[model samples]
Target: MSSMKDAREATFIGRRTDGTRIRRPLSPHLQVYDMVQITSGLSVLNRATGIAWTVGSAFLVWWLMAAASGPQALAKAQWFFSSFLGILVLAGMTAVAWFHTFAGIRHLMWDAGHGFDLPSTWKTGKAVMVATGVATVLTWLIALISW
Candidate 1:
């Protein structure tokens, strides 16, 4: 047990010229990594959008429940939804929904053995971003014009 402990310690630590022990990092750290690239950034965004969509769905459920409860509840819900902050939240949720949809489609393509290469990954990432933006903007434009 003592020999094993020494072996582990020797492998993990180094002695400097002045006899000081220096510990080596156990794994690669963020500081050594390059700036976020499109592939990785989009992957993270995809996960974030998924969570945001789930939360947005909860809000939808609340709105539905409010409508089912009473006229007062429905009115309050409608007023909140029509407020500026609520509109901002709705717009963000819209973007999240679109982004999650596009990212899911991208993942389905990957599962089908497409976009495995670096260039294709980047292309698909950019495509998902653009599609999400366009869809979100168009959705809001239509809603506003109809209103």
Candidate 2:
């Protein structure tokens, strides 16, 4: 009786009382992790930029289609793109694009078995960040000047 009581008191980890084993959340808390700032932060930023780039590309395609449709459609698209809010959004998209491009090149270097050492890895990561910022600024500056 004591043994049976103990068994009943203990947690039965797998399966329900009805006997079908299935996956379920066994705990209320989520699994958390700590990512390295220089490395993991860059990786996460890269992924985010990639997603942003895809969305930006879709918008660009829409703009192109608008142009192809007719002059009225093109004018509407241009008006939206020239608005203050639109310019801000375009700036953000440009920054994300630069960051993604630089990070991608860094990843390619990694694939080529370069910059694998801790020191080189950190250096390259920092370089990629600086390059992204510089590229973004230069791109915006050129756009403003040309316009």
Candidate 3:
């Protein structure tokens, strides 16, 4: 049993014949790959925007809680939301939300076994970006007009 354990450990350690430890190959990372491709950028962006959306949803929850609290709390929340910095945050969250939505749709298409090829991937990525931009702008426009 001890010999078997030692043999297993020796194999795991992976020492070469020259008594040097064998080096494992590095996994692919950002430093190894070109990031110029739209598909890669969009894939990274989708994940990042998902995180952003979660953070943004916290603000929504706060607002809702304020509303439930009372008039004073709701007033304070409204004041903050109407401030310049608040407006900027809102705008960013809006864009993030729209981008996440479109990216999700793109992923669903891919899951359905469509758009696996490079050209299709590129086209879908570009379309998601364009749709996100247009939808975000239109949302803000309608919001401003109604305000």
Candidate 4:
């Protein structure tokens, strides 16, 4: 039992004044620390928007299935989709889509050896954000105007 304790202690790098052992920090421990860079935040947003876009695409499939089912099903789908809450969800989905698209472009630029510097990285991240916002808003505006 004493040897077991020694082994555990040896594994840890240090102990605090309160006698709590500290171990090596693991990757992706975002909750334990503050993010100081725009790049990190943009990276997180890129991943999150990707996930959201995938989930939102399910709604597209649902509408397509509804269309194939017949007029009644299509009518119900249209009604729900035209509702206020549905409009809000659609707006959110639109934003996520544009954000993910812009972020992916930014990544492709990086892969092509562009925007690797700190200032360029931050600028591109901000550009992606602003472009996503403008694109989403313009999409909704055109949709509403056409409707």
* Structural similarity to truth (TM-score) of each candidate: 0.78, 0.76, 0.83, 0.79
Cα misplacement distance, residue 26 of candidate 1 (Å): 4.7
lDDT of 4 at 113: 96
Q: Listing every candidate in turn, what is its Cα RMSD in Å to the true structure after a full C-alpha superposition?
A: 6.0, 8.5, 5.4, 5.7
Residue-level lDDT of model 1, residues 1-147, one tens digit each, is: 124445566777766799987776667746675547887678788888988898789889989999899999988988988899889989999999999999999999999998799988888888998999999999999999987
Give the poorly placed runs of model 2, Cα more than 4 Å off. 1-36
Displacement of residue 32 (Cα, Å) in model 2 is 5.2
Stretches of candidate 1 exceeding 4 Å from the true structure: 1-26
Model 1: what TM-score? 0.78
User: Lowest summed-lDDT stretch of 10 residues in model 4?
Assistant: 1-10
lDDT (Cα) of model 1 = 0.86
Any idea what lDDT model 4 has? 0.86
> Candidate 4 — which pairs collide?
none
How much lDDT does each candidate structure score? 0.86, 0.84, 0.87, 0.86
- For model 2, residues 52-120, the per-residue Cα lDDT tens digits are 899888779879999899999988988988899889879999999989989999999999999899999
Decreasing TM-score order of the candidates: 3, 4, 1, 2
Report the lDDT tens digits of candidate 4 across residue range 1-147.
134455655654666789976764445667755665678888888889989988989989999999999999999988988999888889999999999999999999999999899999889988998999899989999999998
